[model samples]
Target: MGTGTDTPHGARAHARAQHGTRTATMPVVPATDWPDPPCAAGHLVWAETVAGGGYTHRPVARGTEIRLTDLQGDACAHLLLHSQARPWERLNVADTVKVQWNAYLRTGRLLLSDQGRVLATLVADTTDGRHDTLCGTSTLVRNTRRYGDGAAHSATPAGRELLTLAALKNGLDARDLPPSLSFFQGVEVRSGDHGDGDGDGTLHFTGSAGPGGSVTLRAEQDLTVLIANVPHPLDPRPAYTSTPLEVLAWRAAPTRPGDPLWDATPEGHRAFLNTAELLAAKDPS
Candidate 1:
C-alpha cells in the first residue's frame, strides 16, 4: 500500500540529500588576512608628460602634503589647484610659503590651510631654490622644437589639459571658460588697438570635446599678465576641435632662465620674480 504513494516522497528526499551534499557554506576570509600584491615599479596609471602637462582632480584635501622634487637641476615645475571640480587655479607661491613658514615656526611642522588644505610643501630641493608659478608648464611644441620632437622625446600629459578633462568628467562645460584659457595650440596677442582688445594677452586652450557637449582644455596666457589664461565663468562652445589634424604652434618660445619668454613686460616679470623670491626665502629647512 505504501509502495506507490511513498515513492514520490522518497524521490524528493533523495533530491534534497543530493543538493545538501554538493552545497557547503564556507567562512569568509578577512581582508587583513589576505593582502594584495605590491604594484610594479613605474606601473603608474596616472603620470604627467612634459609635453602634455599634469593636474589634480580634487583639491589637495586638507592635511594632504605634496612633495615636489626638481628631478632635473634648474628645472621648473608648474602646479595648479582646483576646489570642488572647478577650474584650475594657480597657487600663489607667497601664500604657500606663508603657510609653510607659519607651520614650521609655530609647531615645528608643515603648514595647513584654514580649510585644512595644505598646498605643496617642498620636502626636498636638490635643484633650484624655488619654483615659479608665473612660468607655467611647457607645451609639446616647446619640447619638440627645443629637444627635437623625435620619437626619443619623453612626452608627458599636459597639466592644464588634465585639469580640464577632470572638470569635464565631473560635469563642467568647457565653453564656459574665458577666452584667456589656452591649450594645445598658441594664439597671438595684439595690442588693444587691434580688434583683439582684451588687456589680457592672447589665451590658448588645447584639449578635446565630445558630441555629448563636454570639453577638455589646456590653456596658457600670453605675456605673463596677471589675468592671462585665467578661466572665465560662463558657458560657450570652444574655439577649437577636441582633436585636430595638425598640431598648433607656440605663440612664443617656452620660458627658460634669461630667455626672452621670461622677459615679459618688466612689470609682469617683476611680480612673478618677487613672488618666486619670497617663496624661496620662506623655505623651511
Candidate 2:
C-alpha cells in the first residue's frame, strides 16, 4: 500500500523494534553480604533486594526454596502464597495455625492451604522463632493516620496497597488477596482469668527481628509468591521506620516422606501427603 521506496525500509525497522521488545528477560541481582553455600550448588534462580515500603511478586516451580532476609532489623516482610495452577487454593492463615496446633512459627512448621495441602514449609529460621500472623499487613488508612502519607510512591506506603498492585501485575485483583504472614516482627498473646476461651487476649507487638534475621521456606507446590517489605501495623513507633529486605530463591527438592520436616508432626505429615497427591496427579511421570 505504501510507496515502493518506503515499504521495504519501514518493514525492516518495525521488525527490529518488535523483536527487541518481545525477548524474554530475567533479573539477577545477587547479594554479596549473605553467603549461601547451598545456593551455589542449587544455582541461584532469583536474587533481589526489595527496598523498604516496596513489594514484589513471582511464580516459581515446585521445590524452589525462597529465603527472605531482613537486611536491617526494622524491615517487616509481609508474605502471601497461592497455587499457580489453581489460583482458588490460597494460603489459609487460620488453617495454618489451627491444623499445626500452634500459633507460633519456627523451623519445620508447615504453611497450609484451606484445601488441607501444604503450600510451603519453614526450613530455616535465623531469628528467635517469633513471627506474627494475627496482625496482618498495614493498610492505607492506618498508614496515613500513623505516618501522614500512605501513597505507594510516598515515604510510607501501606503494605496492603503495595500488595494489591503486585497482584495486578500477576493477573489478579484486590479480591484475590487473603490474610498475609509477616516475618521479622512478632506478636505475643496474653490471656486473663478468662483463660483465652472467650477470645479475650491482648495481642502485643513485641518488636522486630534483630539485624540480618531471616527465614527460608520451601515450596511444596508450584506457587505464586507475593511479598511487601513494610513496617508492621502494630509498630508503636511514631515515625515510619523500615529497612531493606533481601530475597533469594534457588532450586531444591521438596520435602519427602523420610525428611525430618515431613515426619515432624501427624498433622503436617498428612498435609504433605495431600500435596504430594495433587502434584502427582498433575504430572504422572
**Backbone N/Cα/C clashes per model:** 26, 0
lDDT of each: 0.28, 0.85
lDDT by residue (tens digit), candidate 2, 1-285? 553346987777666666523211123443322346447654677777788888888888889999988877988989999899898898999999999888889898899999999999999999987689888899989888888988888999999999999889888889989999999989878766645463467787888768889999999999999999898988888988888888888888989989988888899889999998888898888
Winning candidate number (TM-score): 2
lDDT of 2 at 196: 46
Regions of candidate 2 where Cα sits further than 4 Å from its true position: 1-38, 192-200
Cα RMSD for candidates in order: 19.8, 6.9
Tell me how far the alpha carbon of residue 189 in candidate 1 is from the true structure, in angstroms, after superposition: 23
